[model samples]
Target chain A: MKAIITTTGKDKTGILAEITRYISDANCNVEDISQTIMQGNFVMIMMIDLSRSPLGFAEIKEGLDEIASRSELSIHIQRAEIFEQMHHV
Target chain B: MINSKEILETVRMVDAQNLDVRTITMAVSLIDCISDDGKVCAGKVYDKISRYSANLVKVGNDIATEYGIPIVNKRVSVTPVSIVGASSGAFTEIAKALDRAAIENGIDFIGGYSALVQKGLTDAETRFLKTIPETLAATERVCSSVNVASTKAGTNMDAVKMMGEIVLDTARLTADRDSIGCAKFVVFANAVEDNPFMAGAFCGVGEGECTVNVGVSGPGVVEQAIRNIESGDAADLTAVAETVKRTAFKITRAGMLIANEAAKRLGCKFGIIDLSLAPTPTVGDSVAYVLEAMGLESVGCHGTTAALALLNDAVKKGGVMASNHVGGLSGAFIPVSEDLGMISAVERGALSLDKLEAMTCVCSVGLDMIAVPGDTPASVISAIIADECAIGVVNNKTTAVRVVPAIGKGVGDRVDFGGLLGGAPVMKTNAYSAEKFISRGGRIPAPIHSNKN
Candidate 1:
């Protein structure tokens, strides 16, 4: 399944490195990645193909949360279908 | 690969320009939760709201953070309480329950504690209308409204009389805070179904089971865009309309994205999008500024009417094209005290109550944020509301009045309700009595349009 992951929180070093490492380790192919700073907050949106992943949503969510907690960030994960269903008019 | 620089630049533009989605509101209809047993009805009402809105704020915040936009308020509007209150005194309980649920769920406000008695009042609507002063005073973050007249329903003279009393009583109840209770109350005529605004907004019974509605606003942005354009460049009506349309399109898109995301995250249905150019007390964020951008020295000038009409129409067209769910009273707001430019105009004697009403024919709300002499009798105020409602009925559009009669104050004085209430300069009104006309309590027949095929 293709998935979209977004991370946002206080700015910090190595946030991109840590999150990208997690995605690559899960055997997911990264489709797109974008990051920005707005109103003093850091935000990142990533599109990835998770069909080759070894875990389901819950497991991936837990693993991301652990990394997020360590990095003092907040993360959200949604299936690509859900994302398009919301944005596509 | 997506260029990180492009994304960063976009974020920088938004942050530096103060561009962000203002509100992501959930519109929940309480029509299905109605029951004859008051206790059962209240219980069901509470359960439905709690179940539907429990994670609303959390999800909104989550999505906002994820998307790098600021969702300032997470609000909910239910089916008008009076509709469900037809068989019970449960309105009061429902009001309390809705307020508690919103507070508990971390939402800023819960709206639609209202009654639509435009043509006439049912027994339950009358009861609900009478309880507003107490309801507003007793609960926090619970907004209430009443529709006393409409084009289709004509003007309800009886209901308008009761509303005058309600507004006065509500002001008196919260008089300690300079009538702060009145701030949470609004009396509307020809009320709309999909408005995401407060004090006058209610989920109209004509809408779907559940829908998302957006209220987009950006006076500051619009002002900035027009700042560099020479006054002569905006002299032509078509140019002014195009400018307003383009500005409205951008603002509506931002608000629509946030609202749709919030609805998705909450797993509830999405609704309409309201494209009102709501203003603030800040500099350059006034509807008056838009008027001035059109070469008018002030809002009450002769050309102001023509200017406002074009601006309102352009905003509606642009917003309608941006979202399929566009509904509500989508137009510009001309609240005297709420907009800094308006307050200045009033202080400078450039804007007047009569002119404000004329502008309301082209905008969303009418006679908003206007303060008249305290000693002004309730009957005269009702007359003012009736006059504005007549226009709504004749024109087939939604219009409302929120006039605050500041007690113990006279003409040419000023009352500051502080934030959001902004600062209002008390204006003079004709010292005429309409008591005889208002005391006659009955329904004003629906307009000629209601009889059509």
Candidate 2:
């Protein structure tokens, strides 16, 4: 299964490195990356393949809990079908 | 590649706005389970439900986890028990067994403890009908419905009268619980098969052996879509329609994905997607709030029906294209007790039973979840059913009445069902008696045919 990681909040240093580190540690590969700053608020979306990931979806979510709270960002990881189905059709 | 803006937007829609798949219902036909012996029939009924839908809740949860959209309810709808148990007279005897099956399978509610008597009732049907109060009072998770009218068959006034009295009996039977038993019972005109929503959903004989269906709900998301832009004059009504259409498309798409995945996993037939903007007691998740977001000062005002017509049509237009099949009462549901917006609208006198009757002409259900005075006569309930059925029969649309006769509670009081059924504010009803009309029990013939619009 493929999933999307969306991060939205105020911008700060080392945000990309922090999120990618977690993804890499989970043995997931990021196939696509899109990041931008909209009106001083940072927004980033990473498309990752999770079929071979070492950590399960729930465990990986738990692994990212600390950084999310510390950064005061709203981060969500969801199956990509939600976006694919809604936006395309 | 899917973009970031839509991703965050969808997440926000779920995180803040209440966008959910209202139900993932597995319709298991109990025709094969019918037996002349009542005890044998009950055993087969329980076995079939438990065996077929054992994985329903698990699959529902797995889909919710994978898609990250809240799947609010997992339910089962079966073949109407009346026809299944006609010869046995053990109709009420089956309620507890079905309830046990529901609990064992972890299902929220099981529907289709029902009968269809639009044209006429047999001896078995009439006997089965009288057992409804006991069925409802006895079962913990079973819901009941009866179809008393249809366009082709006309209105069954005799059945209507009996159901009115039955509705009262159900209320009085469960009076200690604020007459919550009536909340589980609904009277329908032109009731459709394959409905996935509870208190009305049933698996018709025409349906296949087994089918899985979905009901999608997203009133708050539509409200957010409209609130994103300015609410202009009548000229902007077109824009409102377009916005609602687009929002419904997305909501229905999400529901379809869940239904398809669940069916694929369980090896069941994928049935229709019911595209309805069903509301809950939650603050922002309400159909009345969507109307307010459309710039209607109040829901039951002069322009309310027009606004609702736009909503109902656009929902169908957008929803039809997103899913392979669409069935059920695929429109907006306006149950007063289940919606905070409608409840407050009634409490403030901004909405009335008369206005709700008018609104139902353009929406999916009629006089739903409304609380009337304890002293309301059975004839009055039958009269209300007659008027609503006339609308459905004439317009060729589905309408229903699910009013609660809250015993010992008059107008200005409230009956709370907690959870999903929510709480209803007792609203003013017409005092005029319809005893003479209802007492003359005879069928109202079908309406004249009209061409497709």
Candidate 3:
């Protein structure tokens, strides 16, 4: 069970640190991270293993609400199978 | 790792556009439940439905939560009641039992209060067909259908006439709710057995003992994708199709996952995924909006059918690879009342019934969710059915009629069906009666195209 965690918003310091702390608290191991700046917005994508995570997707969504709202970031986390189903097949 | 753009695109599809699995339909065969005694048979039918669909709604919600997508409806289809209730003439009891099962199991609606009379009517079928108006008026979740025509067997004008009167009776009997009972009945031509959408889903006689089918709906996603990719002069018809095909592939895959999980949880075999761009009353989620994305001025415009043909074919090309088996009406549905764009077009005089009939030849479902004047003659209604049926029969596609003749409502009046069924402005019908032609009561012979066999 792999999932993708993505955030897009204005650039800021401690952005990666804040995201990493949330992942650790949710007990999900982040395997990869990529960041880019496009059209004056900061975009970050993370690959994580939800298989061993203590939190379910709904619970993770609940826990990320404050981080997303306070940081003014549009965040989305869902199973990677949705994307792989389209692109790979 | 998936690309950042792709992840963002999916989020937009889910969060902004109303992408959803329209239905997860369990096709439960009642072959084993039929008996000589009406009471025992009705009991058996109820027991079988409850046994098979006990976990249907639970499993559907679980999958929706896991995938983070909404599964809008969970329903069941059974063997056509004409056959299941033939021995004892227990059609009403059987309908009641199906409704009880749907309520108890949390299924939205149960279909297959239906009869197939393309060639001719059997004694049992006539008896069952007589009970449709009363049964539908009495029950909340039972849908009934009658197949009045087919290419191979030709049109049964007798059945068509009976269906017209029955539809009128249903409307009058349920007139208190804006004649909404008529919305639950469908008259079909070349109707497929594996349809997962209502008011036309029924488990075919040839199907297995039990199967699970899924109907995937996402007109808004396709519309949004078109909006995102559109640029000046660089994009053309072919590019538009590729975009729709790609989006449809993704939607179909998501639906298949739910179908597999739900079928597994309920201990049934997977049947098929209906690849239809079913619309809703919501503004953005209209099939007409998707057509407008292809640069059409209105859905009933001259070039609408060509654009729809492209969209319908593109969706199939994209969805075909994602599912193990694809059945039902696998194309775009242009139900007028359920689509905001179509409703606006009709209300503003940009669309008409004649043009809509032309559009149905290239779409999945035909002449669907349209409301006509209250005094529209039954013979005229039969003529409409005959015309739509001919399109399906000659073209070898599945098409159906679910017109509501709003009792005491005429042109420009809107009838509210209150939910996903939506509301429709009463569109004008052909004033010239086809009664003289319809009065010639016999099957219209199959066209030359159907002579392949």
Candidate 4:
């Protein structure tokens, strides 16, 4: 259950902390993190192993959406394999 | 130590801002490989190209990764394949070999399977030009071009007429895949050599054996740079030009370093640097955004021309200072289907073909990425190409038409060529016949400007 999460949208404070806390509470292990600012917006791409997830994909997506709404951001969660298949071509 | 919050905020800004280099193209001219023996010439041509461009993809990829910038495409443009094929009588084989070389070297597209027959054609030129359809259809990586007229040479009526047939033939041959052949072919009236831009770059006969040209683009970067400028301040033409010039200068310098490095590594002569602000299919990476930044409600409006002219001039002035050899059509491009802002403009009824043509009079490439109805007559398309070419010739600048007449699609219909073709909304054209006018094929005399002693 390895996943890559990409957060993009309006720039605001504590976005990274809130998302990381959510993942930590879910018992997911963070593998790598990278972020960049482009065109006046903030984006973060995090690769995490969710093998010990407290919840599955749907629950994680729902939880992340709630956090994103509160922070005024957009969150996308996809399987690492899916990301690789889509981009590595 | 850098604060984590500060670094995260910076990352967000970089992604949202869409700061990236669109392409890093290597121009390799094959003019010097000319020889009397056809087989010997083909072998030399292949060996020369392989040796020169072997490391191009690797170098471009390393630089892109090093800078963390997305260099989306790595391409090569040669001296017109026609020039290389003229004496050798190896047009088809040479085209195949060139395509193979590019594919093996991992380049995206290889251009200059071309001919410059503005006034008249040589026997070799005619044979090479006629084979473009077959060559383009047979090869995946090869792109082709033809220059039918120039201000000095006037317009070649015979060549223009022949191109009409050629375009129709090429389109028909590749019609199964939405006429992808036309995607690889462009017909020019005032085609310029030393253009780092494609699918119309050819090493003009006037250029050195090999030279480096840079095509720098940062539409999204430039757009973001001016986003916060007040509308009142943005309305100041000089202020807007200065901002654009500064951004263009930085982007051009980056390209210059890469071109010079690639040239040195390849051991070929470095050429001029082209400072074109090429846009991509992605959102925010658009020339129209640059125009919108200048306080224009939309591109193709009345003030668009003035804005574009100033921007083009400022880019040239700034870029000329950054690099000694600045050539190619170094300006903005207003292609209808290519840029998201432009597509939105068309959808909003703010942009039209005529207005686009007028914009090209000052911008870089002319009448680019326009989509017309599937059933549009070949003659009408030729007339359209002729009119645009006439502008290039009259203005003594490079002008080209990369129009896609999507089969089975009509006006207002959208055809998605996907990826870089973006989404082209079919534009309406006048139904009036230009058959009588285009049918009378004769050369248009070179403009008076070519009479230099």
Candidate 5:
């Protein structure tokens, strides 16, 4: 399954490193990455393939949520199909 | 890959604009649960609901987490209990069972403790209607609705008269709770079978064994979308309608995805998506605010009905093609208590009961979640229902009355139900009595348009 992981917060050091390390540890593959600064905040969108991950979708979300709460960032991991359904169709 | 901006837009809609699947309602038909013995039937009803919807909450939560969108409620709607419990005359007992099942399964509210007496009533239905007040007061999560009129059958003046007394009785019974019982009951004209919103949803006789209907809401999203339009073009009604339609299409598409996935996961037939811009008490997430954003000084002002008409029509136009099946009360909801802007308008003395009645002609529902003075008579309440029914019947649309007569309370007072049910200021009803009209108990003949056959 493919999903999108979006991270948004104030600019901080090692933000990408922290996220990628966590993603790799979960056995998920990053398919694409886009990062930018918008309206004075750091924004990153990662399209990730979760087919290889042993962890369930809920478990992965919980881990991401823990990172978000600790780092004061807004993080969301959602099935990519939702975007395709909303935007493409 | 989807563009970055569109991805963030979806995220912002949820994170900032309160876009959500308002409800994931599993409609369970209780036709097979019927038994001549009321107790036996009640047992079967409970068992079927508990078994069929055992995974509803879990699946709803799972989808909410996976999709990163809020699923506000997980509820169940069953075949009208009046039909299921009629043979046994065990209406209240079945109400208890529905309430128990709701609590046990972690469901929000169980609907369809209802009857369909649009033309006339049978002895069993009449007996069942009498149990509503006590039953509503007794149950914690059971919701009741009565269909007293329809375009095809005209209006049942007798049922309307009875419902008026029943609404007051319910208010007095639950007076301690700010007459909250009335919040769980609604009277409708031209009620739909597939409505996922409550307290009006019921798995109608025409529905299949089981289905999953999704209600999507995003008043804030639509409001923000309109607000995002350039200020110069904001004055243009055509531009406003276009924006609303496009926003509605996106919202409905998301709803379609959720509904189909929920049904697939729950192993049930997929029902329609209700594209209602339902409001919450939160400041930015209000349907009234959407109207206000459309250049209205206040929601109940002179041009409010026209604005609501355009809004309601555009929503259906945009949403119809996004989902294969679109049913339920699919338009803008203006439940005063559940909308912060509406509550504020009433408090500011800008909105009134008469204006609300006029607004319902073009909106999704009628006189919803409004509170009236305790001294209001049942005949007046019946007259109110009759007026709304006349609008619905004559116009071939659905209208409903869910007014709460706050016992011991008068105009300007507030009755709070908290959470999504919110609260409302007790508005004044007219001083005139309609006892004579309501006393002439019979059916109002069907409108001429309804004579299609």
Candidate 6:
């Protein structure tokens, strides 16, 4: 299964490193990454493969939620197929 | 991979626009549960409902989590109890069984305490119809409906008159709770078999054993999409219709995905995706607001019907392309109490019963969640149902009435059913009597179109 994790907040140092560290620790592979900064606001979308992850969807989401709560950020994890279904024919 | 912007847009629809799978109803057939003895039939009905929907809630939650989309309700729709309980004539017993099974499965409501008497009522069906008022009052989660008219069979004036009295009886029975019982009951014309929303859903005889039906809603998303149109094209109805169609296409596609996933997990057939933009009391999630955003001053004002007609047609056009099977009430809903904008419109006297009736000609369903004075005559209520049925029959569409006669409450008073049922102010009805007309009881013959077949 694949999931898209979105992060949005203020731009800051080491934000990318911190988020990747958590995903790497969970044994998930980040297949694609895109990030942009607009007027000091940071936004990033990561497409990750969860097939090899030891953690369940809920467990992985909770960890990301905890990280988001500790920072000025909003994080959401959703199955990638939802995007494919809605945006494509 | 899908583009980043598209992913973000989908997330925004869920997080901010109130886009959701309104209900994922499992249609369970009770044809095998019929028996000669009332108690034995009721027992079988209970067992079948419980067994089929045992994992409904858990699977709904799992899908919600995985997709990050809110699934508001998990429910069950069974074969009409009148047919299943005809031999036993155990209408109340079967209703009680449905209520218990709904609770056991952790689902909100179980529909199908219903009868199809568009042509005429059978002996057992007539007996079952009379139990509706008491059955609704006795059960908390049992929803009931009666189809009294159809284009092919025309309107059954006899059943229509009976339903009018039944509605009043239900209101009086549950008067202590502001006549909440009527909120769980509906009267229909040209009723669809696979409707997932209630109090109108029932597994018609035409349906197979079991299937998953999904009703998706996204009025807020549609409203916002129209709002985002360039100012240069703001006054253009063509642009508005285009925007609405595109948004509805996206919403319906999401629904198809959820319906397929739910049926796969539940080991049932994927029945259909009800392409309806159903509203909720939540502020932005209103169908009325969608119309208002399309440049209407109020939902009931003069051009309201035109705006609603455009919206309803655009939704179906867009939705039909996204889903393989688009059934149920596939258009924009305009229920008063369940929509914040509609409630506001009524409070300001900008909306009225007459205007609502006109609007129903273009909406997915008819005069829903409206409240009238307790003193409103049963004949007048029947007249209202008959008029709405006439529109559905002539136009070849489905329409229904779920009005609540607020017992002991007069005009200007409000009846609150809370949660998704919402609340509505008691609006005045026409004072003229329809007693003589109602007294002429018989089937309103099928329309001329019926002869074509």
TM-score of chain A of each: 0.92, 0.93, 0.93, 0.91, 0.97, 0.97
Those runs of model 6 whose alpha carbons end farther than 4 Å from true positions after fitting are: B233-235
**lDDT tens readout by residue for model 4, B1-453:** 223343333233236655454555566667778887777777887887788778777776655443334566777788787778788778988888888888888888888899888878899998887798788778998889998888777998788878877777777677676767777788887777777776776667777766656676667767775675555444466677777777666666655666676577656677877777777788877889888887789887889898888878887886776778777778777777779989998998998888888887888778888888878888988898888878888887878888877777788888776777677788888878999899999987777887887
Clash number for every model?
A: 7, 0, 0, 26, 0, 0
Best by lDDT: 5
Q: Which 10-residue span in candidate 4 chain A carries the lowest summed lDDT? A: A80-89
Off by over 4 Å in 1: A1-89, B1-13, B231-235
lDDT of 2 by residue, B1-453 (tens): 787778987898898899989999999899988889999999999999999988999888877877888899999999999988986778977777789999999999999999999999989899889999988998889999999999888999999989889999999999999999999899899999999998998899999988999999999999889888774444388888998999889888888888899899878999999999999999789999999888889888889988889999999988997887989988899999999999888988899899999999999777799898877899998898899999888988999999899999999999999998999988777898888889889898877673334
Name the top DockQ candidate: 5
For candidate 3, the TM-score of chain A alone relative to the native chain A: 0.93
State the C-alpha lDDT per candidate.
Answer: 0.77, 0.89, 0.89, 0.75, 0.94, 0.94
- Put down candidate 4 lDDT per residue, A1-89, tens digits, no spaces: 67667788877778899999989999999988988787978888887888888686667777987987877887766555422321122
The superposed Cα distance between candidate 6 and the true structure at residue B320, in angstroms, equals 0.0
Error of 1 at B443 (Å): 3.0
Please provide, for model 6 over B149-261, each residue's C-alpha lDDT reduced to its tens digit, 9 standing for 90 to 100: 99999999999999989999999999999999999999999999999999999999999899999999999999999988946645599988989999999999999999999
Q: Is the docking of candidate 1 incorrect, acceptable, medium or high quality?
A: incorrect
| Model 3 per-residue lDDT tens digits across residues B1-453 | 477777777777777899989999999999988898999999999999999899999888777766667899999999999999999899999999999999999999999999999998899998889899999999999999989888887788888877778988898899899889988999999999999999999999999999999999999999988987876664888899999999899999888877888888888999999989999999789999999988988878889889999999999988897887989888999898899999998987889999999998999889999999989998988889999988988888888999999999999998999899999999999889788888878788877777775
For candidate 3, the TM-score is: 0.95
Q: Model 2: C-alpha RMSD to truth? A: 2.0
lDDT of 1 at B215: 71
* Cα distance off (Å), candidate 5, residue A36: 0.5
Whichever of 2 and 4 has more DockQ, that candidate is 2
Stretches of model 2 off by over 4 angstroms after superposition: A10-14, A62-72, B231-235, B450-453
TM-scores for all candidates: the values are 0.82, 0.96, 0.95, 0.79, 0.99, 0.98
Put the candidates in DockQ order, highest first: 5, 6, 2, 3, 1, 4
